[model samples]
Target chain A: MWTFLVTEIMFFGGMFMAYIAYRHAYPLAFAAASQKLNIILGAINTTVLICSSMTMAMAVHSAALGKKNLLILFLIATLLLGGVFLGIKGVEYHDKWVHHEVPGPNFEFEGADAQHAALYFSLYFGLTGLHASHMIIGAVILIILIVKASKNQFSAHWYTPVEMFGLYWHFVDIVWIFLFPLLYLIDPRK
Target chain B: MSDHIVPVRVYWSVFITLLVMTVVTTSIAYIDLGPFNLLVAMTIAVFKATLVVLFFMHIKYSTNLTKAIVISGFVFLLVMVFFTMCDLLTRNITAPGR
Candidate 1:
């Protein structure tokens, strides 16, 4: 699982590379575009994701303790939190769509650096879209774990799946920890 | 069953620390630190990531080989970014007359 996560790290690392390059090239435009994001929504989502990570850690702990009911409960909590995150993300996306902030033909930015600002939106969608998909996948895996857990398939002796999934879920949370500030908090004073 | 079981209180501590850092980073972004804004933000972010990787991900309890693999992944990532920045940051600094 650690090996797999290494691959995942490299995959996301490529996109972060692009983000660094573009933001360096157009700091003003990136900040201008970033200002359009709703920080309140972003911060709330961050809080949700962090809470889910805690639940996920507890789930893994419950599994290690052979506490079946607690494991299932924590798993469900994690799933619900993940659901809240995606739901809020959907709201943000809809807001962007309504305002034509998405990077496409209809995209509009009322700034001198409209073209470069569009680049920021492109990375914004790419990074967050990919991260959201990971959460969706994690949600599905959580469902599977909750089912297996109900069947008493995990215990102190063997709960590798739960631990591994916990790692992935925490990884996704860490990605958001970085993304929140990078995408939403840029030049907030402005 | 040789796996190290982390205490629940440790998880709680890490989780609370993460939450506090989140609030700190968000609030601090509004202060206009000029070039240091990005630096401070990224610094806080890296610290947060390290906490997650160490505590929630159990890298702190894992075997040495596991530790090496994880560290190498990030080291390679930094190498990629460093070399890319080398190219990009130098692209505009051509010879004096060129």
Candidate 2:
């Protein structure tokens, strides 16, 4: 499982490299393009994800202490927070659609360096889209864990699921931690 | 980790640290620092991410093998990105003759 996650990190690392190159090479373009994204929404999403991370930590704590009910409550809290993050993300993506910021077809930016602007949107969609996919997977994993939890499949003695899930949840949170600034910060107009 | 629950205080501290990091990053974004801007922003982000991995993800309590694997993964990732970007960095603008 750890190896598999490392592989995923490598995948994202490739894109992050591309992001750095483009952002540095065309700083103005990337900034102008990036500024078009809704920072407010991004900030809010960051808050939501941070909250989710807290809940996930609590869930792991509950499992460690054999507090099944607390574990379930915190897990549900984490899940709801995951949903809230996705919900805000949806709104941002919708705004992009109306503004034609979703690259690959009729995307345009009214800023310095059109190509880099396009590149920004491309990265925006690409990174966030991948993150969103992970979130869905995380949610599914949680639902399963929740059900198993009811059956007492997890306890202080056997709770690898809780720990593993916490790891994944924290990972997702870390990704968004990076994403918040990369997508929302810096305006070329400045 | 053997059926021992980490305290609630740990969770609260993690939450507060994350929140503070978020604020710092956002504030830094509004300031202009030339090329250093991206560097500083990304550096702070890396710190925040590390915090999540260490505390929230319990990497601190994880086995040595797990830590080794994770670190190696990031090491290789950095290598891949760095080497690839080396070529990509020196494009048409900085030719020897030009």
Candidate 3:
């Protein structure tokens, strides 16, 4: 699990490097494009992700203590929170689509630096899309865990799956922890 | 492998700290601090990531080998970013005729 996580870090690390380089090249465009994002939705999603992480942690704790019912409950809570996050993300994506902010032929940005602003939106979609995909995978894994947990598969002596999945869930949360500030909170005063 | 079970209280504390830091970072973004705004935001983010890794991920209770593996992953990431930035930031100064 740790090995897999190391690879995941490197994978996301490459995109983060790209983000840093681009933002360095076009700070003004990045800031202007960032302001186009809805901060309220972003903040709420951040809160939801954090709450999910907490519930995921509790789910792991319940598994460790061999509390079968509590483990199932917390896992369901985590799953619901993940669903809410994806729902809000869908709303944000819809808003972007309506405004043609997606980085295809329909992309539009009313700014002097429209080209660089498009680049910003491209990275925005790339990063957040990758993160969202991970959450979707996580939600699938959570469903399986819930099924197994209901069968009393996890317990105090053997809860490795639950614990490992907890690591994955937390890693996803950590990605958003960085993404939130980078994508949505870029010099908002401008 | 022996497992360490973290108390519920610890998880709650870490969770609250992460939420509070999120709020703080978001609020700080609205206040222009020039270049320092990015620095401050990233600082808060790094702090929050550390909390998640150490507590929620149980790195704090893991074996020494696990600790080394995790830290090395991030260390290598930083190295990649650092060297790449070194090149990108100095391309103009190193070869102005390009």
Clashing pairs in 2: none
Model 3, span B1-98: residue lDDT tens: 33788999999999889889988998888888988888999999999999999999988888999999999999999999999999998999899678
| Among all candidates shown, the one with the greatest lDDT | 3
In model 2, the Cα lDDT at residue A14 comes to 75
The candidate with the higher DockQ, 1 or 2, is 1
Q: Score the docking of each candidate (DockQ).
A: 0.81, 0.65, 0.85
lDDT of 2: 0.82
**CAPRI verdict on model 3?**
high
Worst 10 residues of 3 chain A by lDDT: A181-190
Assign candidate 2 its CAPRI class.
Answer: medium
**Tens-digit per-residue lDDT, B1-98, candidate 2:** 43444677877987998888787777777778777767777888898888787777777777888899989988998888778777776666677787
Tell me which of candidates 2 and 3 scores higher on lDDT.
3
